[model samples]
Target: MNLLHSALRLASAESPPPNLNGVVSTPDGIVLLGLRGKPLPAAFDMTQDGDWILPSSATTAPTARNSYPAVASIGRLEDGSTVFTDLEADSVLHLVGNRYRAAELLRNIALELGTSVWAEDLELIVVGLDPDLTPLGHHKVETFDDLRPALQRFTDGLDLSVSELDTGQDGAPARRAAGDPSDALVVTVLVVHGVDLYDERLLKDVCERLLARGRTSAVVLTSSTATSLPGPRLSVDEDGILADVEWAGGHVRAEQMPQDLAVSLLDVLATAQAPDEPVPPAAEEHPWAQQMTIDGAWDPELDEPEPAAEPLPSPARTTEQERRLVRVENDDPDLDDDLAEWGDTETPARPLIAVLGEPQVRAPGGPPPIRAAWQIEVVVYLAFHERGVSREKLTTDLWPDNKATSASNVRRTVAELRPWIGKHPTRPDIEFIPSLSTSGDGRYRITGHLLDWELFRRLRKRAQARAAAGHIADARADYLNALRLVRGPILSPLRNRGYAWLNNPDQHHDTLIPGFVIDTAHELVDLSLAEDDIEKARWAAEVGRLVDPDSTHDSPFLDLMRISHAEGDTGAMRQYAELLLAERDFEVGEDLPPESFEVFNRLFPNGLGRAVDDR
Candidate 1:
């Protein structure tokens, strides 16, 4: 590997440590490195993550001051893992498996934390993984963590404590009490190490919970030898954008990454805890028990799940996690384009619905009658409307514990939908996007030719516009039609588990579509309030605030109070204002509409309402 080789070649330390992958020494001089492929190192310390920073001068410039090359020669290992080859064989040396492992250990131990996945496994196996986490290479790690006892002997009186594993009474609590300099937050972060995109379920849970609470999130891949990462770190911050996670790398030329970039990618391994579900400290630490179905514990919690028992060649457009987006784990730049293609589910495919257009298609009990199975068709239509959902979610909703084969059932359902597809004025309303290979890269596409939901949206917009123009009848009709899409709570075939978190909710969904649903509700509330429909307005406002508490200033309840003022119902206005003020969660802001502010002032002369208390 050019990068690692260069890093080592430049090392100018007096009698510098060898450029082996797993070598370590404390501030004092003691060496540890793995010999051959042995599980344990010949001599070393046992810090879960070892620290290895090259001599500062050696790190930036190679021993041999060679200029950049258009095509850098990098070494590739068979196990899909790679290391940089430095031209400065003198100043820098390639550091791959063992070195990487040593770094992993030192950094973590410095942070006073344990490696979640390899806590007990001092022997590490470093494999090259593509951005999508596909194994491109592998290599056994020979590191200092394997020689905890020997290193302790060497230090004698050094200020340190290293161990073989972290799970048992590792004495962290004792260390902390003794002023080891750590807090509960640091400990919590330590617990979530060894997790990442590979843990799809955990990722979903974390993102959803965060969104529900209106808390901003960042998914930056960081680097640090200490518990905390440093440098010109890029954070996603409060804005919901994909750029934060994308900065690490689309595809890593594992063999050629600069030492800094390599360290950055390591951060993606996800040792820092981003809650699977934000369990309040007051609640059980782990609300959900582990259901271990896989072996080999490198964070099995985040390990890629096995394909469904029956891996069926799904109909065009159906994919699992079609929206996870494709990522490249290699150094290949072309990977981004290929990934983009997988995500653009929009296409010309017609709805997966059955058609009523076929002549003689309508038959009696002797034939596959027209409406014998309209349920599947409706479900598929809803799926299409949702921009596509995952099979796990769909199955969970449809057959919670039923063992019936899912493929056969889905196929049978698709067959049933073929007859009535064209019934909707917009035939393109439904479609099944194709999936990309066994890797499960994909996206759901809504066809441009479809006018179903868009028509409803347009009607809703027009209704709002006309209502402002005092065209009540027309506006009401459009509003009713737009709400028709809600015929049954966003519609998921998933039956019993609960789907409220879905495009349609019942329980199938793990959580609600916090952002989207909240926005929709608020919009509807604004319309209802403008139309003087106080009851509908208040209901919409409450739902909106529940979805996102920050929307308090614009909640429908507040708007209705203002309408009451214009209608001159001072009593009703006070009653509605009091109701809004009683909402336990909403923190009303000073930015309330001027009209609403006036009405609120009238209702609560003291600028505070205490007629009732919220739970």
Candidate 2:
């Protein structure tokens, strides 16, 4: 017992005792069949009268997402901000705040699980944990009021930890007239059984996500987790029978067993769990710190100061929040003289994304014409951050009010964008310019990143180091090649007009193809809608309403009209929540956030939630 008495006996052990009487029950309030209530489900209780409003239902009911919320707060929403004043429910958030909180909780749980069980499969849910855990403390993370019965009691009942049996056979995997090949060394043995044995730092965080491909091959093993229970759960017949692995664990450990073989060996020794994968763990905290705890609610104290956020009419694809640095051929000449005294180059940092295709609006009339408001806003904000963006958040997102006439229309759109940028023989002394800063002093400064935003920061750091080594199908083929080059839109919207990108400003670089096609249709609807896929949740709500026709009345096309009203039609789910509150005015807009419409009010329950219950 050395290392300082094993670090003072692992700091007097922690966690396990605070189960708060382990309540855990579930299900309540509204969401009858769509399911959601578990923890944070008590927000909306509206009802007006004249102008007939009426929102009342969500007091706490939610039970359908892979089930279990009773207190499930995953948190992370940035796409332009505003989930309770621009996000901040910190549990964790890494790779670009886990791709902006996994594209807003996988598009609100793939439209409240249209294909059920949080569908979207391009994988990458990740979550190993224990980097000295402490966002709230004692493993604290239970804030769900309603989210499908606390995600059906934490994905069918949070076992927490239990798996220890591998009696050592050398090697064993191929078991069939088919996959039958063996060496028999299957050791899992984990037992953090609700964490205790001197609180082994989250069971050594399951050996930091197991994977060993090869290195003096004992198949190169490690992560052993367990306290007991790598058996049981039978019921198999149709020829691939084992009568329950011969009455549950008594013979032929390997041989013709692909079917239930004791529920495929209880899903092969269950105990690798590590779900809530956000992971930022506060690298100086950023994901919006719970939207800065209502930081004066943007402007209520001064009796109203929050009115600014509207820009992007193409002073070259404007809108840049923070993470827009994009550095490549680093010489550090004071960061290349702060990127040429501030033209912000290095091409949006290069990873190789590709989602493009926008440019067909303003047609049905005659007026929308007068352009060149400084050469298409610096040639569409450096071709919408070299074709992929969701950050670097430009001032009021591209010039809201008048950051000095949007920095004099971005220094006169970078003097006709130094003659249309074209060459860069892989960073030939760098060039893809555009960037200025100023979210501080007296405020109002625009411009940022360009090196094709480092192809989504090098395919999200090589698909998160190939999913931390396990390489789940090569991190789902690099998240579908970083979501097909993310088509194009990170600043283009056919003219929000500007002092800085004031919303549309006659869209150049074609609103970066609907902001990289609705951010890769919300990251391919965050992977086939969490893996369920009601036809890819109606083709990711039809490419997020064909590149934003106001998201066909938003909330992912009212979650495809609540999955076509649960496959039937309670009058088309009350006419898709009374057509998103009569022709799309359904609460929360100054850019977006009424909790980003938590799955469109759990599935469209219109009526200005009585003005979000008057706050």
Candidate 3:
């Protein structure tokens, strides 16, 4: 069941299944490490000739793979027998050899043990290693800067486990029978890159104490200099091969994890353990429903006649009004010249499909003929994939479960969509040219119509280019212009209904579009704040929130908190802080992201004080 659960999680994270190729049957308590060279006499009783003898146990099923948490593979003999180590039974395993080789071998052991199916209750405390293992994101895997504190914590935990066992409620044997082996004395493995960092006496004392208990706890030490300690010592050569062991006649390749593969595996593990999908906000709670426009304009409905005396504008209101006026008046021709090279040739006579917000085909002639949801989807898909999608790929993605009818369905949908997309201005024969070739296997692509998303991307690119060239003011304008093109979230109309392909992590529209929106808004907010334009800053933050209502990125909420603090609005500051905290709750074991917590602490040194105090 554990193996099955891990496989399912890997699938969800879009990662390859675990490689179980070398896995073979092993004894119950012996634990299968990598293979060792078998004696010629031992090979006589084996199924195959050269690499046969594996420590077999009657209790273990013939087909069962290595029981992880209890087993670890160190290296393989030249004849292909895997060398096994019983981590649960072994109290201390000292790795001595070239510092770099030993460290690499230790890292591989940690990776294998950490990513095992039964590693949920396994705690790995690593010291003096700079490997970027954080991407694994497992709550149990931790890195410590100093050995003293980590050792102290380990001893404390050991004492607690020992005390729990003494209670006699349920001993380790009983817990193992119930299939919850970790209930008593969680499997904690301490991996130290350099054993010489601590006093040799203290290290030996700790290991001896752990060995005395005979629990599923152990310490793995790696060192460059030769040192004698209790338990087995495996010397690693500069080439990462095991030496001074009777297990082989030499030429054993150690199991080493490449940097890239480790990172990829860690990413897979992180994704598999990601927090539950956050619920979408209700329609009323959505940014669009809060009287806030995507471009940061507030369009409140008038409830009564205007007052005879004009009300004094708050700092936010004054800046917002001025910003609006600046946008309307085309007073600067130089800004136009900076963007002239990238500007569109001319506006389309027909309304282009709008996908930046709601998925819609705006045909100026009359109501669009595109009535089916699939028709709009087809057009939107082509608009995003300008390179064109093959018919098979499109059908496969769109109708994954109903492959038999998908080809016909896609053909009919495209046919219905092409007419509404309209013909190219100069080419009457190309009626939107939904397909590039007359051949049946030709690719499907939409042309002759512009996409709002494309325009948004163009403006954003220009803004970044301008900013890189040190044209701050022009860059700000470009960012604002790009933001104004966004009506709401990308494909807001298809929130829960369709477009399952967008959920893929590789899709640019799913990942990159939101990043672009958040970045643009964040930059705008910073620029506004730099100029002391409080209202503009507030507006920029709201625009960011409008696109990312879930507050996935911390910058938007952080911007708002700063804006509220600058305006001396404690009430608003507290609200933004709470929202920021909720959004950052995805972090495992941590209260908040570092930057968010820092801002929160700065705003409310006495903790998010009572809301009534602000009043």
Candidate 4:
């Protein structure tokens, strides 16, 4: 068919479709713009594969505008003079009548549109169908919530198309991992029937964004009104004859073309272009378009979304709770009055317990003597210097051979101990064992007393620090003080009994003593040796060896042997060597360490040493 016939046929085919604004066709892609809930034309390229529809509004009557809300309905520009409002669910005439903030909106649209069009070779096409169509049409996109989801959908379609072209898979990554960013292009076509249908500010803003991107656009406007957008221009006279209208600001040339050019452009660009004579027919339904229903939750009267208010300031801190707890713990004179505000449901104050020596009462004349019982055993076992004792330790230490009864027995023992300690005058008002909330592993602790072992450890650590600082006198004083506090093995009176549950034949019987105590014994031995007190060193080493038969504690027992040799006590040296030998044999099930023999050789120069040399 000739150009005239083709033009006449295209013009005759044009008809007004409700909610269907117009078609936007680039060199390679097409987009359909319209109102929500309208069926698309079957004859048009409804591939849905590359189509994106932005729903303007529901076909409902306009509602009243609400007062200024949390979310700003209108945002000001950098100059603070211009205010932009949402176009979604609002009429173009209404928005234009109020001089809509089209420039700011258009700037955002341009940026988004540029990002959305990701194909390298398609020409940018903008068609104006209605002479008064605004940038938002009937839909609104003001904040991130409104724009991001729709923009993502459009980009997702582009990504899918690029993936299919590169790898023939729906969502597979593009094969060109290192491809230039420009190679993966985005081509967007804005379609409207008439330029006059859009707000003038919006038109100017759209033109500016396009020009900034170095794109020269073509506009179809009446011969009279001049557009600032510098590009190729097509003027249609009242008679519908196409004329090349020149503006002073125009840079790109436009040839005088027929008024039916858009129809021909649509027919050419919207249809599938297959290299072969025929292409396979597209599926009737696609997920992309099927999911494009208008999300109709627009309460027209409401204002734009605002930020949530900050929370009220918290009340000032008070020491009343601490004071109450302290008073209850100290058995104070005003305990009842101080605790009056605390209701029955409120937690009772916990006792301030001490365990530095026999777990006695630190408060003067508060509590009388604490009798020796399983409660004392529980305290010693629970108090591991700074570390918490394990539940297994409590169960085993309390009920050695009876595995089944251990858990229940431990519970009973703790229950009895709680009341017993609470009855003490020092902490009569406080619950000694506050709660059964132990660690994840069911470990327990004594809450009432300050443990002596903890004080001993702190003193020993301080002594070591002093020695390292060259304060020998201070260190010696601290060491003496720490050793004086030992009194006896960690638990003292209870150490001999109540640990039948420590029935580990694999470890020596002496392993019943906590490892921390054994370590403390080793520290004492070292301090004694450093002080050059042979008697004290011997005592400390013996205690360490007795408590740690496995020698796993790695005490300084060898130092004791060396000290014996230095003192010329052959018998004592031999005894220490024998002990060392026995320890090594226990550990490795082998002969004594060579260092033990060295001790013997040193003690008996010409005796065992000569015999070994002869061999």
Cα lDDT of candidate 4 equals 0.35
Cα deviation at 160, candidate 1, in Å, is: 40
lDDT of 3 at 583: 62
Cα lDDT tens digits, model 1, 115-144, are 221111111212222121111112212122
lDDT on C-alpha atoms for all candidate structures: 0.31, 0.29, 0.56, 0.35
Q: Which one is best on TM-score?
A: 3
lDDT of 1 at 31: 19
Off by over 4 Å in 3: 1-351, 364-366, 403-409, 436-441, 468-470, 495-497, 583-590, 598-615
lDDT of 3 by residue, 352-406 (tens): 7776677876542334444656667766777766567887878776776765475
RMSD of each: 27.2, 25.3, 22.1, 35.1
Candidate 4 lands at a TM-score of 0.31
TM-score-better candidate, 1 vs 4? 4
Q: Ranking under TM-score, best-scoring first?
A: 3, 4, 1, 2
- Which of the two, 3 or 4, has more lDDT? 3
In lDDT terms, how accurate is model 3?
A: 0.56
TM-score (all chains, Cα) for each model: 0.28, 0.22, 0.46, 0.31
Model 2 stretches with alpha carbons more than 4 Å out: 1-24, 27-554, 559-615
